[model samples]
Target chain A: MRDVAIVAFAQSNCQRDAGAQNEVELIMPVLTEVFKQTGIKSAQDVDFTCSGSCDYQQGAAFAFVAGVDALGAVPPIKESHVEMDAAWALYEAWLKIQMGSAESALLYGFGKSSPGELPIVLSQQLDPYYLAPLWVDTIAFAAMQARTMLDSGEITEADMAEVVARSRNNALKNPHAQLKGDQTVADLLKEATYVSPLRRHDCCPISDGACAMIICTIEKAEEWGKPYAIIKGIDHRIETHHIGSRDLSRSVSTEIAGKAAGVANGPVDVAELYAPFSHQEIILKKALGLGDDTVINPSGGVLAGNVMMASGLSRIGEVAMRIIRGEAKRGVAHATSGPCLQQNLITVLEAK
Target chain B: MAQLAAVVGVGQTKYKTKRKDVSIAGMVREAAVNALEDAGLTWNDIDAVIIGKAPDMFEGVIMPELYLTDALGCNGKPMLRVHTAGSVGGSTAIVAATYVQSGVFKRILTVSFEKQSESNAMWALSNPQPFSPHLNAGAGGYFAPIIREYMRRSNAPYDAGIKVAVKDRLHGAKNPLAHLQLPEITMKEVEDSPMLWEPLRFLEACPSSDGACAMVIANEELAAKSPRKPAWIRGAAMRSEPTMYAGREQVNPRAGIDCAKDVYAQAGIHNPRKDLDCAEVYVPFSWYEPMWLENLGFADEGKGWELTMSGATSLTEGGDIPWNPSGGVLCSNPIGASGMIRFAEAAQQVRGEAGDHQVDGAKTALGHAYGGGAQFYSMWVVSSEKA
Candidate 1:
């Protein structure tokens, strides 16, 4: 594969309510910032542009078409869209570069989950015939997974609380984080469960925001004169849609994707895992087999602010930023979709 | 150098106003299974799966590919969903081919579909946005003005669109899978149709359809093993421009022009009219047939109508070039799947498997799709010969 690198990254502040702002407004600032950071004058400066977003987030067909208005695509730019997290969008961009179709690409993702009841909205993502009619929200699925782990003696409620505790502590350093505090595991465990074993704090916030990143062939990054992180490997895998067919406590897809991504080839100095729920982080970490030396979610991960489609790409950006800032040398970023992590993407980034 | 990719198999579910017998998942699997069977491969042969559809609202299912994991044999495999307006079907196919072209996956399953039966497409498409104008113009209302502008600019004959509607329906008569099969359609019949959007009669506008298209794309090595003749992808390109920007020509979008130019450049074609055997251009509206002929450089500006009038785009043996031999989007449009049908039809023509609608001895063909207020465009050139 060609040497693809992340040259720049920018994001909007995670907010509970964007307050009358539409998707285009949520996306424009970050797109403008990434272009400015890369020193590229406009959207035309990039060889390609791709975005990741969900139409269901706004309850409209072809809703993502509006997001393109922010790109100022007057002269027409090579572009595509993914109904997925921006992390997958990044993967598509990487593929374009590897195929020699493009040298530089700008990718972004956005979502506004506050307008509707998020869990109810997410219920629509389930299988229309079997699960959606039940209104089986995302949290309910996570709760089932957590309960399975608890019943199987695989993890404790306190363990899930610790994940939240650490996330809160780490999010304190992230300016864009929506929820951050210095809470301890003991305090979190004391809180009542909102759904059986899963507590209110165990869930990621319903944030409305967008994120943008610019990547290029290493040669193009050099010409752009910017610090960058090499994307050493990336892969994604999905599990069966039938929940009954999957092992709820284990992330088989993440493990397969992680191994394919070469997550074990080198020491991971930092990692950003997109586990929207607390217990899924434990599931992902064990699947990835990360060591204690790796700093997990220094940018607080999605629990600080779950920007829906943007959260996964944000995880990748967080790891890339740490590597670029000399805070780490190598890292693995992860993103998940569907109920109970039916699909997962793993990306490895390293300082050149 | 990028690895060459080829389409070893192509399949489509019957294009109809609604396939009420099957569920959405069942309908998609029909196409995928047909494609795999055509490739003479099983589910285990595919390395990855990529699916595309316009929007979740159309089916009332967000990211329906997730629900279709098992249906497409994507479990424990890499899967991605693409959405790029009406161009999504073409873009999805391109993404699947890229995986093969990048040497990441040797064989991939790509599918695109729309189940208009699940909901009202026009109502779903007309949903109001927060900041956008509330003109309440659905897709046809939005495009009619653009079609009018094309006529004004080119000073084309008023009968040009009616001719397209009749011609494509006649082609549809040859394909059993097509939604509209008016074997004896005539100019009078089309002209007698009600004018829904001024110059565009109801017959001139594409019918809403429920269908799916699937293709199996493989690298050269894997394609060589296939029993079927492969349609080698010579070049693929996609372009997008902002909506409502000043200087943006809605009629002849620059994105469409640039996309065609890029793909043609890669394919080493200087004259689309001469080099391409036929084209499966996306023409949800009849006028788009001529409009895109100019935009794709098949004819000079203002002369696309002349090409149509001269019968250059007829499917019969007398025509120099053919367009939409598979009846195309105007005859059977399932929105998301319409673009892939165009791509798949082109591949089929080059592979000499287009049956009755086949352009005789077709060696090279073009597949094109555009979307979103004419701002998004995707095109590909495929040939019987290797890239």
Candidate 2:
């Protein structure tokens, strides 16, 4: 495989409601930041460009097409888009580089989840004939999964609270994080359940934001003289979509993808996981076989602020940033789609 | 150099206004199973699945791939969902081909579909948004002015679009799966049809369709071992520009020209009209035929209508360079699947498996698709021989 590395990454400050800002407005700032970081004037500098976004977040069809305006895609450029998270867009760009179709790529993901009923909008992702018509929102599905873990003695209410408390504490240092505080596990446990077993703190806050990243062949990174994080391995796997068909207490897809991504190839200094719920962080940590040796979610992860499509790519950027900043030598970044962790992607990054 | 890949198998569902006999999952599976069967393989042979469609609103199903994992045999494998407006089908196929060309996976199953019957596409496409003009009235309403501009610039005959509608419908008659099979269609019928958009008549527009298209792309090693001949992928290119921008040329988009040039260059073709055996281009409205003919270099600007008037783009007319032998988007437009149908039909031509709509002794062909006010373009060149 051709060597590829993430040399630049930028993201908007996660906002609970980016009032009146359209999709293009939410995306332009991050695109400008990434361009500034990489010294590239516009998307025209990259060999290829790809994006990830969902239209439901904006309550409009073909909403992502507007994102092109943020890139100033004049004279045309090789570009593609995915309905999934931007991490998958990154994967597509990586494949392009691997195929020698491009030496460098620009990718981004954005969402205006605050414009609509975020959880209810996510219900449309379920089985259209069965689950979607019933309108079982995303929180209900995650709540059921958390209840399964509680009933199976796999986790306790305190365990979930502890995860939330850590996320709140870690997020205090992340300026872009929307939710942050020094709340303790005891304080979080006192909060009433928002959906039976899942408390408000246990769930990730719906956020409106965008993130952009620039990756290139190792040679290109050297030519730019930028600090970079080498992408050693990346792979994704999906489980059966039926909620009853799989074990909710365990993230089988995450385990499979983590293994395939070579997560255990060496010591992981840190890991950034896109676990929207507090209990999911525990499920993912166990699934990836990370011990106390690996610091998890130093940037507070999505539980601090979840920007739908952008959250997944932000997880990857968080890990790569740590490696590039010399805060960590190696790390694992995970991105998940579908309810109950039905699909999972693991990307391993290491410092040069 | 990147590893080579080829289209070893192709399958498409019978186009219709509504496929009531099957669910969305069933419709996609039918095409996938057909493609797998054509490749003489099974579900286990595919390493990954890449699916594409226009928008979640078109079917009221958000990210349908999540619910379709089992139907596509994508469980425990990588599944990528591509959405690039109307050009997504072709983009999805290209993404699948890259899985092999990148040497990450050997066999990839790529599918694009639209079950427009589940919801109203016209309403979904024209949903009002803040600060945006509400003047948009579906795709035809947007393209009619562009077509009018082409006619004004070229001074082409008023009947140029009518002829194209007649010719493509005739071609659609030969393909059993096409949604519209108007074997007896005439220019008079098209010209007399209700004018939906100024120059574009009701008959000149493509029907809203419910269907799916699938293809199995494989690495050179696996493609060579396939039971049937493979259409070697000589080149694939995709280009995109902002939908509305100052000084943007909507009549003949620069993205279309650049994409065609890039793919042709990769295929080692200097003159598209002579180097290509045939083309299956996206033509939802009849007037786009001549407009794209110029954009794709089949004819020079202001002269594309001349080629159309001469029957150079008609298969039954014994034209040297026929376009859309299997009818194309004009006959069967499932929005998302429309682009891949062009791509798959191009492969069928080179593979000598197009049956009744087969181009004679076709060894090289071009598949083209454009979307979003013609600002997005995807094109690929395929040949019988490997480079």
Candidate 3:
């Protein structure tokens, strides 16, 4: 396999609501920043382009088609789309690079989460024949998982508050974070509950954002002389559609994808997880078997800015940037889709 | 280099206006079972499943693959869903092939389908939303101006569009699975038909269809062990651009040209008109037959209409490059499955299984599909001989 590396990455700031901009407007800045970093003049220089976006988010079908204009596709360029997280777009670009079909690939993902009621919109992802008809919102779904953990004596309400405290403090350092403050666990415990035992701090705010990344072979990475983040391994898996069919306390998909991605082989120095809700981060850390010494979500994570589709790839871009700047040697990035992480993808990246 | 991929088995449901006789799951299963049977394998032999479609609104099922996991026999394996407008069928197959080419999976199952009968396609296509102009006009309304431009640039006769409608309809008569099979269609009948859009008569447009198409792709080891003949994928390519921009040319789209060039180069075909035996292109409208002939390099610009008028696209005629021998989208169009049918028909011709619509001694076949205001394109070349 040819050695593929992440050469460039950029993203628009996560906002609670960017009413003036649509998806296309939100993506223009990200595309410009990525190109400016590489010094490439034309879209033709990029051999392959791929994007990740959802029709539901934009409230329109084929919404991503307008994104092509940001790349200035005048003579037309080789491209593809995935109705998935932008991270998968990066994965497809990586495979194209590995095949030697394209020397360089550009990947982008965007979402406008503020357009609709997220909890209501997310319910549509459930088993439409059964669960969706009930109209059980996403918070209520997460509440069930939290209740299961509480009943099993695995965690307490105070433990959840501590998680909120730590995440909010971490977000204070991130300029793009939508939620950031300095508060203690005691302070969070006194907050009113939004979904019984799950306070407002436990849930991430609805955010609008976009992200872009560039991938190239190791030879090309050196030719360009940019700090490189090598994708060591990647895998994804899905569970039964019915939330009740599987154990809510555990994520079988994460375990499967993690094992396939060789999560146990070497020491993981850092972890960036796509956990929109607080308890999900706890569940993911346990599933990944991270040690206490391993740092997690130093960039405030999704708890600070959950931009739906783009948030997942932004986690990857953030970790790659850390390695590109000589901050970390090895890291793991995780992305999830569906209610309560029914589907999961794991990628291991290394700086060599 | 990676192990080359080949289509060991191919399957498709009967093209029709509506397959209400079966549910969406049943429609996909029909094609999947046929492909597995053709390969002499079972669901257990498959490693993963990749499925795609134009939009979830077509069936009122958002991410329907989740509901279809059990029906597709992909519960315990990895299943991926790709959506890239109408070209998704071809892109879905290419993604599955990549798994084998990347040495990840040995045998992969790829399928794409559309149950247009479930919902009104015209309404679903024109759903109004925020921050976008309402496309109240249907596909014909969107494509009329481009057709007018093609006529002006080519300086073709007014009867040229009618000739295409007559030719493909006559060709549809030979295929049993076609949706619109008129045994005796005439140029006068087409010309006199109600005009839905200027430069395009009602008969010149493809019918709304309900159908599915599937294939089983495998690596070298499993491909060599297949019971039936295999159509080696000589080349495959996909390209896309913005739907509209300040200076974008809608008449002769560059996306089509770039995609064709990429695939032709990979297939080592310097002169498509002379090297290719036949082509199954996406012609939802009759005029697209000639437009694509020029875009795909099968004929020179401003002369594609001449090729269609000279009876060169007929299977029985001694034409340089016979086009749409299996009736094509003009006769049968299940929006999502239409693209895969082009792919399956190409494989069928190279495998020598196309009974009545077979092009004599067809060795090289082109499968093409485009969508979204002609901004997206997917093309592939299959050969009887391995590259």
Best by DockQ: 2
Model 1 root-mean-square deviation = 1.1
DockQ head-to-head 1 vs 2, winner = 2
TM-scores of the models, in the given order?
Answer: 0.99, 0.99, 0.96
Write the residue-wise lDDT of candidate 1 on A1-352 in tens digits: 6678998999999999998898889999999899888998878889888899987777666778888888877778888999999999999999989988889999999999877898998898888998899999999999999999999999998899889999999989999999999999999988888988899999998999999999999999898889999999999999999998888989999999999999999999999999999999999999999988888898888888999999999999989988899999999999999999999999999999
Q: List the residue pairs that clash in candidate 2.
A: none
- Per-residue alpha-carbon lDDT of candidate 3 for residues A30-69, written as tens digits (9 for 90 to 100): 8888887877765678889988888877777777777777
Model 3 CA deviation exceeding 4 Å by range: B316-320
lDDT tens per residue, model 1, B118-194: 89988888888767677576889989998899899999999999988988898888899999989988899889999
Interface RMSD of 2: 0.7
lDDT of 2 by residue, B302-373 (tens): 999999999999999989999999998889999999999999999999999999999899999999888887
lDDT of each: 0.91, 0.93, 0.84
What DockQ would candidate 1 receive versus the native complex?
Answer: 0.85
DockQ scores for all predicted structures: 0.85, 0.90, 0.51
DockQ of 3: 0.51
- Candidate 2: CAPRI quality band: high
